[model samples]
Target: MAEKKTPPPNNNRQFAVWGLIILLMLIVFTVAQSGASRPAPGETFTFSDFRERVEASEVQSAKIDIPGGVVTGKLRNGEDYSVNVPPVSADPAGEILDGSGVPYEYAEKTEPSVLANILLSLLPLLIIIGLFFLVFRNMQGGGRGGAMSFGKSKAKLLTENTKRVTFEDVAGVESAKEDLKEVVEFLKDPSKFTRLGARIPTGALLVGPPGTGKTLLARAVAGEAGVPFFTISGSDFVEMFVGVGASRVREMFAEARKHAPCIIFIDEIDAVGRHRGVGTSGGHEEREQTLNQLLVEMDGFEGQEGVIIVAATNRPDVLDKALLRPGRFDRQIEVPYPDIQGREKILEVHMRGKPMAADIDVKYIARGTPGFSGADLANLVNEAALLSARRNKLKITMREFEDARDKVMMGAERRTLAMSDEEKAMTAYHEAGHAIVGLNMEGSLPIHKATIIPRGRALGMVQYLPERDQISQSRQEMIARMAMAMGGRAAEELHFGYDKVTSGASSDIEQVTRIATAMVTEWGLSDEIGPIAYKDTDQQSFHPGIGRGSAISPETAKLIESEIKRFVTEAHDKAREILTDKKDDWIALAEALLEYETLSGDEIKALLDDGTKPKRPDLSGGKRPTVSPVPTTKSSKGPKTIGGPSEA
Candidate 1:
């Protein structure tokens, strides 16, 4: 049996303290209000009536409160009455009362004590100061320490007893895991390397794109070594006050020294680790001071023998050079996007508890998702399970996974978007042109699917799904891709007359232009441009009065521009020639898209191979089922610009 723990009594004590403060304020207000002038316990009488009665000698006794301006007396009939009077020392009523020979006394005005007067004056100031103290105390996270702990490190310590995540929880980045395994060994037994006079790595930097499991790998190290883990973000060290960040760095390292064998994990170190003097504010900035302190703490005169620092950042290029040297960050581990087999393994890990259909193939899903990170795969599995639950299915099927992949890559289907007949026909022909050109081009990727249904910002799209992950592209492949991009505009101009062509091909023109420019400037595909790399100058480097501009001269710039234009013109001609030769096939495919709205790779191949029309499956009551688009390799979907000036 487990022992049940109760909340601490300090919470009740704090509440009681707050209640007492409120009660004291209320008592002060009540006492001040009680001292104010109040009506006497008697019928209010006019001053003239009281004077006439006093002159008749009907009043027996009376008392006058001078400050309160009220006169109270008892009549001969024993009735009590109060009369309003002026609060002046010399009045005719006083003389009349004295002449009537009625026994009366003047009530003396009472004065507050000296201490009470001082307290009443300072009450508002005290309350305001108390409120400020309470706000600062709450902002300091309620009694962790004092209100002015701005220089204290915000690092949270996680002991081994917390929820443990081993290497099994991490997948898809095997190389990064392997590189960190030695750090675990060092934490377990430092003698293995120390015997040979080899010091353990002071720090390891995990560099990768976002969502590549960098932070997860760090947690796995702590779990494997069964050591304490101190985690904080790079931004947590910085503060608005100068020297605060440096103080925090010193405090964090001092605390880390207490638990010598522990690991300090800094997530997103780029926030504080950027190059120092590059900013316009110069090196005296608070962030630079923090980074300087961090550099010294990692490799300064005093040794941090058993404490290992693990940092993760997506932007390694922005980090300071001194931080990446031999003693500071000894190992720079690259956690790149997973390949096909690694993605499959990642999928299997994510699908551990999911109720998957028996016949579902994980490899197929992995193949279709070429560039998906581990986090992406996890999201895909979650999305698939949600879709299955939505359809009231017991197990997650292949169809559900495919639909989730589509939704993850391309945006959800815009089923309610109503398009005019003319717009719909134009979209169909435009997408059909892309598919036709890609199918005919020798080195182009296989056409996966084509659809006129709007998904994301695209009014229509043709997806090019690569069979394998492409590490690099050849010259032919690049040319073929440009031709495919030009295909959409080429079809629009041919079907509608040149004058009637819409601005729907604006995205296509942009894609073609980008590819042509890259081919000329960076890829060295142009014969005149030669193999020399003419890339853009680094704009981030600071040089006073020197504007960051083009690296090449005007003459060379004009030559590059002409080469880009030549490549685009050739691609455009190639697309037009292909469309003219395969004119009947292109028209048939467009008509099929008009009827079905979408076509898969197999269905399209069958349609173009022979003259057979592709039939959409009638899944629900003789109505055709809507087929959504799939993921693509390059440019997922081309935008269909409408109501804009056409690009030349």
Candidate 2:
């Protein structure tokens, strides 16, 4: 592996190195002074004693370094001594030797050289420069959360000149593209709109679910306009220090103004634009201040003519009212989940550089994927290619794509999960319950698959395939949907005795409960609720779980709970009735599951078809008709009597 690159050494370290050099020079000067002032090996003497000795003619030869105020001499007995005396006189050493009248040679004091003079003169300036360099480096190396550099906007710009993504690269969200086409035209030629009475739109908001290509749409805008792009997240505007977020907001807009006709994309704008006056502290905090600054920059003093703002968020419900008014973000373009034809186009775009088998059909794949987003489809295509490569195939085949889709929707296959024989039998019946009820239910969704292999958190899964995109649902369809969700547990209770039914339908139970509760409380489908939505949310701001702190009486709350339970129980009864009449098909499907371990929609259809074929009875005369009747609303009174404790 390559080594991680590290930052180079800083000025502080160089400062320490220079400081050490200066310290060493001072230490050397002290050592030289000490050595020069040392007395010779014989003995030490006071200044008066040394002068007396010198005057007594005991000193034979004396040498002095006047610059350092030191004298060294040898006596007549050949013992050497040295002295460091004060400069009491103009020539203390020479005068001392002359007063003694001893034989002594004088050495003139030497002057400092030109190089040493220059170094000494510049030493203070060099130390000052090192200090300044260290301080400057510290300021320049300031990191995140540091108090010093708050005004710097954290927006990252696309530096390269090349266009990485054009309109062709973005495969979905055609409506959003159409809305932005005007913005691109405005950027290309402002006169086209300015010539008329049209005032250019200050901003456009792209609202959608997480993986619906909101960010990708922004890039396509830049690539189409051929303008510089400045991209930042709303969270980047916040900082720990007070007033920092507002400062960053001002700085980001100022930067955009530098590059005229530029696109500034702020992703996840809800982070900074949440509804004000929330919680006990209210809007006095820094987030409100940051939002206030952003509002001003977008349209207040700076009218934001040359720079167009494109903000995106999955939670538009929480944004402040002022931030999303008509003057600012005048157009709210929703990038919704793709339709069938759109999904096909998205899949074809993703399949561009990959080898695929001729039999693989994009339209068929799109039909099976009912609720997949753009990102989901892209990942599906990539996963299919990887599965094909794993099998060492030259091109991805239909079988690999099927497995990939199954893995994406359900978790990865767990063939080695090792289920006991009894457990496997119970799972087969539970899944077969879903298949039988889903197929028999009137006006219910289609069943794409049923499998008993362990995937993700569930031991088995019954995958339903919706025929077309459903923008809304009718009351009957909602009830049928709930019944299909509860079919698994109902089948288990019928096949195995009520006392022996397993908790394998916990997930299914949860799904039905949510749908039923929404039907009564949110969707107002219940007759008792009278089409009034008693929802727990603030409608104006669209913020969930913040509904003006309204209170519901205990009696009304009880009634809501009862209605939810009644809806689910009714659906469970319908599912049980349908499964009981088709006992033969139910058993046949379980047996099929045990034998095959999995069954696709077509395979399940064939199994049910073969099971329904007419067969001969024993040679003895048949007693009563052996044929089973298809269930209807006539006999939906079986499982409603016994209350099975099915906990989700």
Top candidate by TM-score: 1
Model 1, span 597-625: residue lDDT tens:
87888899999898666665532234322
CA error at residue 305 for candidate 2, angstroms: 3.1
Write candidate 2's Cα lDDT for 38-124 as tens digits. 445555566777788877788888876665566777888988777776644476767778777776776675565676666667767
Q: Each model's TM-score?
A: 0.85, 0.74
Residue-level lDDT for 487 in candidate 2: 77
lDDT for each candidate structure: 0.80, 0.75
Q: Give the TM-score of candidate 2.
A: 0.74
